[model samples]
Target: MEKSEFDLIKSYFAPLASGYEEAFDLLNDAALISEKPQASTVVTMDTLIAGVHFLMSDPAGDIARKCLRVNLSDLAAMGAAAFGYSLSMAYNSQIDVGWVKEFTTALGEDQQRFSCHLIGGDTVVTPGPLTITITCFGSVARHQCLKRNTAEVGEDVWVSGDLGDSAAGLKLLNKELDVSDAEARAQLIHRYRVPEPRCDLGIELLQNAISRTAMDVSDGLLADLGHIARASNIAVELYEDKIPRSAAFSALMSSSPDLGLALAVTGGDDYEIVFTSDPAQEQAIQELSRKLSLKLSKIGKVVSGHGVRLICRNGKTFLPTKAGWTHF
Candidate 1:
């Protein structure tokens, strides 16, 4: 017997709404939210297509987590705490009851881990590729959310975690690059599959007034930073040597230094936060990083200019052939 859409939702997704009373056990047509007097809701949506955002060969569980986490990354960029998310799925013949079970189970686990819950959503059959869209909602203190345009000249630009591993991982998965080291391969693949959202760090930055301007690094560092530059009406200068990279990524660079460096700056899918803070806040930011046990790299500075500039280790300006990822 084939499971109907309603049956699939009841058996798999409804349980994920367990702790959220407003979800009404997935029986109601809509979910409700009560006002938080001193907070504002932050909503973000991201859609993932099977072939475009992720590989069809990837596990169902990872695909589900990636969909949720990427939206969560947006919330983190705004320094908000995630509360709930509504998900919509367009499934193809490739997805069966077993696949739904695995997908929803992963979402359930991440909900608990991130202190959020499933609120409401829809599911439908698609003749095309399987697609997942998630609209995540979070809350921040009233009038305290971060914005890219708030950056000021002389403020230091900082980025959380390393970059480019996800791009490297993609190459590895596509067989464009071969890494014999088992550990390095696994690390890069994991980074590509599951990006760790800097939720805690974002919250701290906002609540403590450490940074006023920020955004998540989804579209490569250089491209994403360009967004900040345009928004704030300023230029940024980054030192190539200062851009953080994981040890595995650094080791991989040893084989093809130019390619590795380009990938690190121009590769997308790294969900780390890029923010700017006053130089006076430097020690405090460093202390916060130590307390959270997350690496925070001071990579660049905002200046009175138009765009981003990259300085090579040899004291020369480095020009990249490509700025970042683009879908056209």
Candidate 2:
């Protein structure tokens, strides 16, 4: 039997709205979000296209999770608690009911893990490759949202978890690099496929008044920090050794030190949070890190100037030929 678009939604997507009464079982054209007193809504959207954002050969479940997680990373950057998301998918002949079942199963798992619900969305057939777009909605205290321009001079720059694993993972996946260690190889590939968003850290930073300036490192760390520097009209002095790296990343770097450092600093797809806070909050930040069991590394500081500078261990400055990934 040929399945229609409505059948696709009813079978795979409608069940994702189990807890969200306002979603109306994905039958309505739109979903309603009631106002929460003294709170502001945060909305973020991201689109992923086949062969561009992800490989077509990847597992359908992973592809679905990555699509949702990237948008969740955006909400985390703003210190927002995700409530719900609206998903849109354009599928080609390559996708079938079985593939969609796996995809929606992943979304259902993530919805439970993140405490968010699926609201509504549209599905359409396209002759081109499959594409997915997700719009995530979250909430934060009124007028207390984090901003890139709110960084103050002399504040400490911090990042959650290790870096460069994702880029290394991509290299391995593309066969540009090979790892002797099977465990390390698998870890890197996993990081590339599924990025962990620092939602709790973002909320702690904003709610506790620990920091006001933050942005997730979707691009290279250097490039994203450059954003904070440019936005705040300040300069950043980053210590190359201070940038955190996992054991797998370090092993890869041990084989190629220069390339490792460059990739770690400039490689994109690291969804970790890069935030700034006053030095006085160091103890509090450390406590938060321990409480959350997430590594928070203090990598640099904001100074009065323009642009970002990477300082090497030898007290010399190191500059990359290319700053980061760019669409253009």
Candidate 3:
């Protein structure tokens, strides 16, 4: 008796689409488009469910942006540029016409910002929580793409932007902290809603051979660095004092002594780039950051060991209780 929201949204995509089925035709055969000479294609996919990846109370538009950004962060980890993407959505009955419009508007804006073209995807009615799946494809020169297993001893560890913002933002949403300042609260909330993917920085690093190995800090710094250490078969030693902290985060740490800095070190969803380079490339990275107006700082160095060790200024060893988030 009622026109479904899915039908209404499907009509909007039909007119502007090149061909929905044609877009997926390439993927259906289990083969990607042929690679260019001496070039490599980087592909990554991430799925987010309403309650699992986001709160049901969050704005639909913000949820849509998060779905795209988290997937884009994966591409940044390998120093890839966005080429195209596909989205599969499982819509529940609760998706009203206004919600769909807002969600699609945000998705379109992100697609433009990231320079990615949406090919095609399946949308269907579901009986459960809202689910969105995005698969992103990117490209890099064969030798330029940073691999997780490429870190070397003596390589300098670097991170772009301060850590702990996203985790702190979530805490604020849960009302764990009562930050009275509007601007400070807004900054934390922004980190949670729209994570900067560091795509431009990642591409520049690859093009200029700035980083020997790289990974985006979707997970917390300490935990993510541990991943690079494990993957590259090298140990990493980070100076706790050297790790950068945002002004808001610093204030939170000072006020909430029980809320350990370890959360910032081990929390997830920072989405900044964590990379490894050496002394030889340090100047080059610095130059690139200056030219691009990106803040890139060396926080630590790779060592010869199996795991990560945090060295405090007082010569105390700090090991994180948790490594990172596990979907399983």
Residue range with the least summed lDDT across 10 consecutive positions in model 2: 319-328
Clashing pairs in 1: none
Best by lDDT: 1
Sorted on lDDT, best first, the list reads: 1, 2, 3
**TM-scores of the candidates in the order shown:** 0.97, 0.97, 0.89
Clash counts for all predictions = 0, 0, 0
* lDDT of candidate 1 over 93-177, digit per residue (tens): 8888888888899999899899999999999989999989999999988877988899899999999999989999998999988
Worst 10 residues of 3 by lDDT: 12-21
Give the Cα RMSD of candidate 2: 1.6
Off by over 4 Å in 1: 321-328
> lDDT at 243 for candidate 1?
92
- After superposition, which runs of candidate 3 have C-alpha atoms over 4 Å from their true positions? 1-9, 14-38, 257-260, 322-328
Across 100-168, the per-residue lDDT of candidate 3 in tens digits comes to 777877777777788775665667878899899988888889857777899999889998888888888
Give each model's whole-structure lDDT.
Answer: 0.90, 0.89, 0.78
Q: Which model is ahead, 2 or 3, in terms of TM-score?
A: 2
Clashing pairs in 2: none
